[model samples]
Target chain A: MTQYAFYFNGKRCTGCKTCELACKDRYDLTPEISYRKVFEYGGGDWTKDADGFYVPDVFTYYVSVACNHCDDPACTKVCPTGAMHKDADGGLVLVDADRCIGCGYCHMACPYNAPKVDREKGHTVKCDGCAERVAAGQKPICVEACPLRALDFGTKEEMEQAHGDSQVADIAPLPQKEYTHPNLYVDPCKHAQMANEATGKVANILEVM
Target chain B: MDGMLTAFDEITLVLFTTLAPAGALAYVLVALPLIVSGDRLLEEARRRLDRFLCVPVVVAMIGLVASATHLGNPANALYVITGFGRSPLSNEVVCGSVFLSAAGIFWLTSFSEGPGRIGVRGVVVAIISVLGLVFVGVISLAYDASTILTWNTPYTPLTTWLNALSGGPLLAILTMRLARFYTAGHKLGRALVALAALALVASVIVYGLWGSLLPELRNSLASAAELAPLFMPSIGLFALLGIAALVLGFKAATWHGEAPLWLPITSTVLMLVAIFLMRFQFYMIHMTVGVGV
Candidate 1:
């Protein structure tokens, strides 16, 4: 029962969205659905000094996110049909398409906005951690496609061992880590804000949604 | 802006929540006379009321069908029972099914043997009434997910029950008129009107308090204020329609003779529309604790 995890180096990501496009291409997703999303979060206003000189205080950063496969997923908790469940073998959250009624409860409960109800598919769809690739001893398509090597994937113990335990998961534009205890680890960049900070906003809302 | 899209995407659900609870309560209210004092009513009046029970039952069925259409795959709906007692939605579905089944059985039985014995019929109606109230409560709990800040409050269930109370009596009055039960100037009719009036005023106060709480509910993706910009105006319209409906209900209850058929009918429609408006706003203000826009 080894839990898999995703590691993101925020400092290396340039918000190019290559990972997003790569996952879309791999999954052949429609325009409305994306397994991965890159959010551009930015905020801060200018302040005037005593000398009447205006000073800028704006900051911005990119947060590439997909399903974190949290230990306490809100989506799985609210699903009426038990269609969404966390796999016991890989500790990966997966949807059983045969049982899904596509009520959108998963979509509404997920804090990361990962799962979506595809009306054409007649069920909710989301990232399943690229289980096939992992089975073949290869990384996810998005991780392999990241030119800057910002994204990594491995067992949760390995990720925490390699990138110290302290930076496991916490960043702005995401909820408090205590809420879901996401498996995704992060190496925050200079402009990164804590999860509790309310000053910043998701700047590229149109692109993300 | 995203909230509006989310709301529009769930338009069928909005309609379901608006109609189902009120319809369930209406059925209970219409049956209250039979359950409480069936022996006192003339046999002809009892038969007429029993026959007209189909009206509220049909309204509830329409709501259930509307909810089924919201499912992406209706074929898998039966699997929902697997999550019963575990998921709030599953509990809601199960409760609604039980209530509808009881109501359907009672309605079917009324057609045979001239409304059956008074004692037996009264007991069955009492059971259905209890199921109906439980169904409404389950519906309210369906949206009480902790992840949804806008809906995870006492006000959610409070307002839901109040909405059912405010709209249910009018629908029952309409059903009574259709059956020619002649409730005008009766104690029961006056009590219903008074109950509706009280619920309407309480609904207004609760909604106002809920609206005030919305400003503080925010996340990185959106705020409740941004999600529901027209909250005040929507409530204003609700109040106007509610007052109008109350006025019509009062007039019909206190009328000197048999009230005009159009009076209760119009009042019921107005109240249902008002409830629908609030349900629409409920969807519009959907804000998650994080990026779940």
Candidate 2:
């Protein structure tokens, strides 16, 4: 019953987007599709302190994300053809390309927007935690391609041991983790930001593209 | 949220979301009255039902075909039931298919020259009609997912269920006219028209109450204020047409063929049009929570 997870160091990530490109290249994804995305998360305000001096409460950072391969995957729950499913070995969420009706139900159900309908391929596609590469004893292309070495992946306990506890991680502009229990662990930037803060606002529209 | 909607989001799904329920409703409404008729009228009712029942079946078939078109591969759709236990969608498809098949078989039996067991046919059609209604209910609840907060509201299920009640009779009235059976002003006619009007009014009330909660929910990702304009107009239209259609249908019933054929026809068409407009806008408003935003 071992589960794999992702560890993101938001403090070091510079939003370089190399992970996005490397993922597209690895999967041969078209211009419209990218398995990995780097979000530029930032928000702030200048406020007057009790000392009558202006204080800045602003911060910006990058969050690299892909499929969380959630413990309770919503996409698999809604799939009509049993197309979207969880991999037996790593509990990695995977789609059966042959079984998918291209109904896009998984796309709608996923809170993380993990699944995308490939119009040309006539099926849904998503990150499968690089199952092939992982089985072959290689890291996912995104982790290997990170310049700052900000991304890490391994079993949940291993990642927690290497990085810190992920229970408190909050990457703003992304959804609250409670919805999906996503297997993603983020080490927040220096500025403290709580999960569910700025709930509906995405701080990084331009950088995502 | 992205202001622009893609082609698939706009039109491809309109046919399934709109026509499928309309067809299902028509079938249920048309069959229910026949199933409940007295033995004296049972023969005539069977003749009428057999002749006109195919209209709703064809409508449902067209909708089913449109749904298949949305699939990535229609050839693999026959296996939809394979995920029956895990997916509400599979259950919905299975329900819809069963209703269609049952209705089709009943309609074929109507072609017989003799009565062919009126009691049996009546019981069968009654059960099938109820199943069709349940099928519509299933479709409504199928969209209740945590990810799409806008769709998870009680309004989604209420609107679909009410539409079947409010729109079914109108389609049935038009269908009756097409079959050339004069039913205007009969007890069943008035009862059904009254049912439609009351249901339409109820649907409007529910929509208004549901809409008023949107502002508070806006912060919670449960708001769909962007869809208000498109949806609001349809509610008004359904109410107005619901009244007009009932009045015309009742008037024609009392006139005993003196009224022009167009009276009920025009009213039903307007109601159907309003329902379609609502459904088209319904699919256009699909919003999801999380990363894609």
Candidate 3:
């Protein structure tokens, strides 16, 4: 009956995969199957007073990600079989293999690439936030293993109380398309400039049908 | 012995590359549904109960069989029913059931007709058309491979859906004309045909410019060789097919014209080919998350 939340702090994150390795090891997972990933961006608009030309022009920041467990999960909506389900009280998304037809619809619909396909089993597996471990009064393997103290887990109010005041929160914006509203939020970063430059480059490449 | 290994090498590479192209088979998922419920749409006997007979039970049955290939495990396919709670695939199952139910009602009503049957016919057909198209949208999104950028966007769903709306009516009108059922009266048919054609043209243009074209290249599909294999003659053939459908459609609606079979069928077939090829080449040209590596 407890509410749960996941938080990512960009400033303290050092682009380390320690948390990822810990989570994967705990799950006995193979490579690229990490329930969590730390995404790093190197270059941006440089400041005139900046130190080195060879360094990332503007800023160097890292963002760690896991499932948001949204109240309205798109993964559940696109699931073709009854395999994917959500725990109502805590907003946890879980997949039941017994009912999974292995259609891969949930894997396609997810914006953050949260789900990893188990090609061998013909199904998907993602961060369950170590729900079983959490239930036993132990933190998720990933959160417990983070050396940077960059991750947090607790009640929704507790998360807000713990890191809510930090300068680095966008109420948790996750990377998503304009079409659907995703539950995750991004702490506003200079990603817009980089995205704009990327867009401008693609614009000149005339599309041919 | 080396030659045999070389042959084996070629086959393995080909199959691996084609694993994604094999996804192209999803198109049939949209077509067979119409064949299952198409006959009733053209006839205008008009009743939800009677339209079930339109799909041609064999055609609908084919949809079931064709769908199984896409599944990794045939026996576990039954589990698709449980996922409807969280999945569009489930919605498709439900929508298709409603469509089939409407079709069944139409079939059962044929044995006895009264004022109630007349009233029920139109409502059922309209609803089933909506439901059938909904299933197409669901299936379009269900295919998971992200490398196929053409199929990644909503464009796949929109085009997949219009495939039925545009093609089914064409088939129904053709069959009705052959049956000599007066055929949606004449003016109505022209209006429908013209409307459908206009939609097709607009959709093709959008698809050409927005979705199919490789964003990396200046001219991907629009190149002379890709767009037309027979030089300028290909354009002429495309125009001929298009204009033939439009002119013949209007003629059929006006005075006496050929039965509806040839014109719309040809139009639908050509449009389907163009879209499918566009999809195929789109697959050839697309670049996904990490191509060079």
Best by TM-score: 1
Provide backbone clash counts, one per model.
Answer: 0, 3, 25
Fraction of native contacts (fnat) of each candidate: 0.77, 0.66, 0.32
lDDT of 3 by residue, B120-215 (tens): 444554555455555555555543334333345655555454444434344444443444434334755665576557755755554555433333
DockQ of each: 0.83, 0.58, 0.16
Which CAPRI level is candidate 1?
Answer: high
Q: State model 2's lDDT.
A: 0.73
Interface RMSD of 3: 8.3
- Interface RMSD of the candidates, in order: 0.8, 3.0, 8.3
Ranking of all predicted structures according to TM-score, beginning with the best and ending with the worst = 1, 2, 3
Kindly indicate the candidate among 1 and 3 with the higher TM-score.
1
Highest lDDT, which number? 1
Candidate 2 residues B96-120, lDDT tens each?
Answer: 8898898888788778777677778
Tell me the docking grade of candidate 3: incorrect
RMSD of each: 1.4, 2.8, 10.3
Residue-level error in angstroms, candidate 1, position A44: 0.8
Q: How many residue pairs of model 3 clash at the backbone?
A: 25
Chain A TM-score of candidate 1 vs. true chain A: 0.97
Q: lDDT of candidate 1 vs native?
A: 0.88
